[model samples]
Target: MVEEAPYRRIAAEIRERIARGDLAPGDRIPSTREITRDWGVAMATATKVINALREAGLVETRSGAGSVVIDRSSPQVEVVIQPDVPAHAGGFHVAASPRLRRAGEPELNRDRVVSSAVAIADAEGLSMLTMRRVAADLGVATMSLYRHVPSKEELILAMIDAVFGENPLPEEPPADWRARLETAARQMWQSFAAHPWAAEPLSLTRPQLLPNVLPYSEWSLGTLRELGFGVDEMMHIHLSLFGHVRASALNLDAELRAREDTGVTNDEWADQHGDELEAVLSAAAERFSALRYVAERGFDYDIAAVFESGLRLLLDGVAVALARREVSGDEQVDLSVV
Candidate 1:
């Protein structure tokens, strides 16, 4: 009698959950870490379990969302599992347990390893990510992961590429350059919002040259080129837009960490400090007239609203600067006037 592999056993249990409808369609499936924690398996084993479920059409990976139970009612193709036969007859019989995988299973691949890593970084911040941690989630031995990903840095780069690949570029961008730029900026902002940790790795000065990230630059530069902007100007515009989004997203990780450590949200923290803030503002009202006025009027401090407003203002200023340069035929327009 051949005992089932650890991964197969874990896969069988998840399959049973899906079959029982305990994991409804579109519901997030357990991640590698969650599986490891629950089943007391290594990361490699957890990865294999997810792979098995994927091969069996029980779950699918969602960018920044982790693995989700698929709608089994609409399976692309029906898979029929053969019954187990006796070992003496050169075939194994189906065991009484429902959770066993068939005789042969697919080997682990780089794609699965990267996707699992991305899921972990997305759920927790990048700080929580580690090679051993990722392996533990997958239920595989720590050493087994080295075969797929050489290092944590390489894994992070792969994760970035995977995230950028999630949203496909439009076949036809909006006709107007301003509209197109706005659309691109908003999309970038939304991506940062979804994966807060992503903003930290992306740098304006030291930009990464990943496959998915390059297209965004090409798209933005191409749009500006159509508007008669020089290459230098186009590149500046692209960097500015990306930098703005990244800057706004910088606080997301810190805020999330603060909440986790203190069990207090941003609003709660602000509320707790409100009395101290009021006393300080009142004491310095004469010197800080503007700050005091704004404080008295009250502010909602919504990050999304602020991001959109700043983006719109930035684009509007850029449009004005472009117009000035066009009318004056000046190669250098004083952008500060806008």
Candidate 2:
């Protein structure tokens, strides 16, 4: 007779309680923190216990709420996929996938914690992301999260690293310096677009030293160095490119908030209030000629296009500086003019 695993045994106990109706549906279940205290088990074991219960279709995570018993009578229940556990093995029939981890549901770890935080920040703005919110998203105890991440600041740092790590820099970048710089800038832009909340935290003035981001810096700076640019020039150019992306990305969160609050996109919102805007512009046409001129023609705003155009202009300026440096024999090229 082999001994059952501690996690399985604890899971069985909870399962029995649920079956007996002692832990009724819609009632909050013991969090991982509670389970560890009650069962005298490790936090990982506690997570496994919850994983088992969740896999059995006995509980579901509610946003802004912790795990609760699932109502058997209800037609739908949120399902959390466990990587090791085969899907639809014993749980209720899942009609659709929830906006939760499924493709690769690895065990709870720092990476998982960071990924969850990223997801939350991506869906909702960073302002709305909290420890409790991430815990609820993971269907684990908020305290258990601390075992993996010491603090929210640490978790955020980890999140920044994780986002940057998604797209690896090429080992052999494009031979052309301009092409290399453009490649790096566009990659950074894509990352910010994916997780709009990430841009602000990745500061320009007081930059967070992220391991994954170091390669990008090396690639960008190395490209400049190969082109004979001085260290000062390299840093300035790199920052200029980085800052451009960050500046555009900074608006992403605010734009997202407006869309969510107003339930319309920028263009839609403008159209909805177009008459009022036109009336104001019409009244102040002489003073606001430029505004009225563009307003009359209508501006189609696309952040991606704006970012690309800005990147091109910045690189063009860099090219001019390089040209000046070549002619001046390594002397510092003045960048005050175009």
* Per-model CA lDDT versus the true structure: 0.71, 0.75
Mind giving the per-residue lDDT tens digits that candidate 1 earns over 41-80?
Answer: 8866776676566545466555566778766555343433
- Runs off by more than 4 Å, candidate 1: 1-106, 330-338
Cα lDDT for residue 289, model 1?
A: 87
lDDT of 1 at 307: 84
Where does candidate 2 have its weakest 10-residue lDDT segment? 89-98
Give per-model CA RMSD.
Answer: 8.6, 12.5
Error of 2 at 256 (Å): 2.0
Clashes of each: 21, 0
Candidate 1 global lDDT: 0.71
Candidate 2 lDDT over residue span 212-293, tens digit each: 8878888988878877788999999999999998998887667866775455899998899999989998998899999999
